[model samples]
Target: MTVTERRATTRAAPGPRPAQPPRAVAVGVPRLLYVLALAGLALLTLPVLALLVRADWPGVPAAITSPEALSALGLSLRTALAATALCLLLGVPLAVVLARTPTRAADVVRALVTLPLVLPPTVGGIALLYLLGRRGLVGEQLDLLFGIRIPFTTTAVVIAQAFVALPFLVIALEGALRSAGDRYEVVAATLGAGRWTVLRRITLPLAAPGLVSGTVLCFARALGEFGATALFAGNSAGVTRTMPLAIYTAFNGAGVTQDSAVALSLLLVVVAVVILVLARAWKPGGRG
Candidate 1:
């Protein structure tokens, strides 16, 4: 019963297993993705770098100081800011509706609101013309009744930019709204707070970061807008012309220095970078 049986039992017990190394193929997908992502980043970044490299540093000051350039920049900033304001005014409510509503119409409306994001800016410009031109559908009525023709003006520039950029604000705000927990609202209501009071005091504060990021993104996009503004507003210097339009004009003309365009492009790149950095630094209560 003795030594032989004990030895056999002891031998039958499991021994320490050797550790296995991770498979090379197991890590391949993520490595491939990393490489591809880096490649994409390089491709996107190179053009901006090239623009900066091509820019004449000395001429940049002169070019930007020129009346044409200054006017374009000023107009671009004004119109872009106006467009961002319009987006905030309209997009926040749309986002709340999309986030809270259960109806099928809400889905459709949300989709419609995002349509501009996918649509070509040129096509959007043309659509705006059809809707608001002197002979356009309701535009004719406005022309006759109020003597208002919206095309080829600063207002037209703002409208076009807003149409293109509104989707960004809507998407951002919708994401924030959905991510935000309703527990605060419930607590506020239990404390005798009204819907508007809760929204103003609680919801908006919680969603501030997303709102700020979206506004920055919308403004950046509006600032860089070329196709819609050019087409709808007509690229007239000191009137409808913006920074992007000015860049295009400079690129097209023999007398115009290419460095001027490069400098302007660099300016946009810097602005985008600053906005992105600020967005990354921002934290809102609802992120959790």
Candidate 2:
């Protein structure tokens, strides 16, 4: 191109780029959506705020320090941690299967895996009771062969919590796996890496964030489990009565006070908040 023609073209070019939307517009596009979004945020947060405001702060120390309350808290933490471990051990594999397989059977498996999420907790309790109760299908065999009874025990609480919490872990990890895609795995395999090695070194590391998130969610859910534990585990103090059961007992089960219930509820909320904060602070592939 000639110098003069190039100069003329440069001169005729758009002087400045068109102005983008103003900051306010960028922040608040679709005014209705913005309002609704704020409303949704408020709906989720306000209840917690109210709980904090209405908490019996003076009675908290006494209530939470009570023997019954202490026992329930200890049991809740233990079973919830156990449930989280179970979810991690089992849910990760289930998530990998769901993410890697696309067959109809996989779909059925996925549906069955997620059934507890939509299923009422009470119904899930009944289902677990049928499967693991003393006279239940597999339960009967367990009793006959090994003399193991599952219901109305700490083991039952763990089982109930795990059942309710498994789906959260699986769903989160499966989403992460799907989002990560299989290209990295394929590449690793092409480079002569074995299946197990690739998974342990590449896939799982990539999905660590999801795994952590899912595990936290699982712990929180398991900690708060009520209906299933009530039915399958029974509300026996120091045996199966978790924090939720303790709170319920305080509220409606004879010989307990509302202050105790509020205190326990507040304690649960604080624990959940701490879990969230810890999760957010976690850095994948970084030093703790």
Candidate 3:
């Protein structure tokens, strides 16, 4: 090496060593927390396990396939689907309003919309009755104008289910909308897109995942609806008798046996499980 080069190399200090990244911490959960978690899990799971164990596995197929059971299942599916549709129709607009608007009145409206989630289902049924029963204010006007009956009917069942399930759809969609923010929507507006176009093309597409999840939750809640349905629609055979109602009937009614109730309960559980699994597996249209 040249003397000048050697002198320069010796004069310069070595570059600072590259900084090492910090190591991740290893967390140790307390034993008490583990015990409590296990206890809570057991509390939630043991009853379902007991029901499964109590069910007459050999008789389940025959019991659930009987004419009465089949009718109830069919009615439940129809009403639940109808209710889910209703929730989607009404909930999307409501969620949009709630997510976009920032006002006290909007907060009150949101609370009112979700009130049924905390209210007892039976109270909801009574409220429905007061609002739509034959003697009700709206019902009386409807009957006077069109001779329409509201209570103790298939329509009533759908309304009851929708009433109870609407909150789930609204909450989910609102959260999704809030998380998605208004960036794309603002850009669309700047580009001269109309409100409806922005909603249809950008907002709805972005929130599709939440919409699917909310729809599934609403459908499941509707499928298991009982107290509101019973009080508002009545548990008539092949009519308002949904699976939950049928299970209740079979357990208490003189015509059906407890074994049938157990079978129907198992069927409902299986259906719920399948829906949850499908919801988890579902991928939104635009998600990566």
Candidate 4:
């Protein structure tokens, strides 16, 4: 063999050529979707932005500190928190049942649990009134036996909020329970753990993320509840009136302009955003 040929044969083959960068795909559809998403985001953000813009800085502190406003805020916070607690207490079990059960009734139960999500808040108020208002179904018995009427009171506010928010918690916890495989529960059973022990030790811990997320979402929804709260509870300072009711009052009150209403709305928005941020930050790996 020639020396040059021999030398070339001895040399290692050249490494594979570096891969070419991927080419951009057609732009029309993607660009359109991006623009649409941005538009939707902007639309969602516009009301909050307008509220902030129209706020009267000098008037805000006074408005917020006013007795009526303070009372409504307090009531709102108290009722919302109570409702959230109730939702967590009841929703977690219902979610577990929905996730674990395989009976034909399970589907029906799940649908019933989620019915409040689609039911109009005003309709929920009416339903609650029918069931619990003075002279209504259970209300008459409660009043006759215990002297307790449920409607047009703080309890009504809580019930209304819970009615609306429970569905959120149920859906979230159900998804979490479903996503968390049954292997851990099986392992716990094999290890001689009881059903409740397995749930408490293995299932609950694994579903913590979903449970926390659902609780936060439920709290947020309860905080902003308006229609059912207003319809069933009625506006009563330090009793049933909440922030949203106060906003309505301010909007409708003579000599109170839309700017004032906007300012109050901005305050609600800020509180909601802070809650969401905290909820996200509290998660182990940040919110998904």
Ranking by lDDT: 3, 2, 4, 1
lDDT of each residue in 12-104, candidate 1, tens digit only: 999999999977774346678888999999999888778777778878888877888889889998999999999999989988888888699
Query: Can you write out model 2's per-residue Cα lDDT over 110-160, one digit (the tens) per residue?
Result: 999999999999998999999999889899999999999999999999999
Question: Which pairs of residues clash in candidate 2, taking residues 3 or more apart in a chain or in different chains?
Answer: none
Off by over 4 Å in 1: 1-29, 284-288
Colliding residue pairs in candidate 4: none
Model 1 poorest 10 in a row by lDDT: 279-288
Give candidate 4 misplaced runs (Cα > 4 Å). Answer: 1-29, 285-288
Candidate 2 ranges beyond 4 A from true positions: 1-27, 253-256
- In the range 113-194, model 4's lDDT, one tens digit per residue, is 8898899999998998888888789988999999998888899999999999999999998899899979989988998999
For candidate 3, give the lDDT. Answer: 0.93
The TM-scores of all predictions, comma-separated, are 0.86, 0.88, 0.91, 0.88
| lDDT agreement with native, every candidate | 0.86, 0.92, 0.93, 0.87
Q: Estimate the TM-score for candidate 3.
A: 0.91
Q: What lDDT tens digits, residue by residue, belong to model 3 across residues 1-288? A: 999999899889698799999999999999999999999999999989999998888888899899998999999999999999999999999999999999999999999998999999999999999888888879878888999998999999999999999999999999999999999999999999999999999999898888889999999999999999999999899878999999998999543389889889989999999999989988976433
Using lDDT as the measure, which candidate wins? Answer: 3
Better candidate number, 1 or 3, judged by lDDT: 3
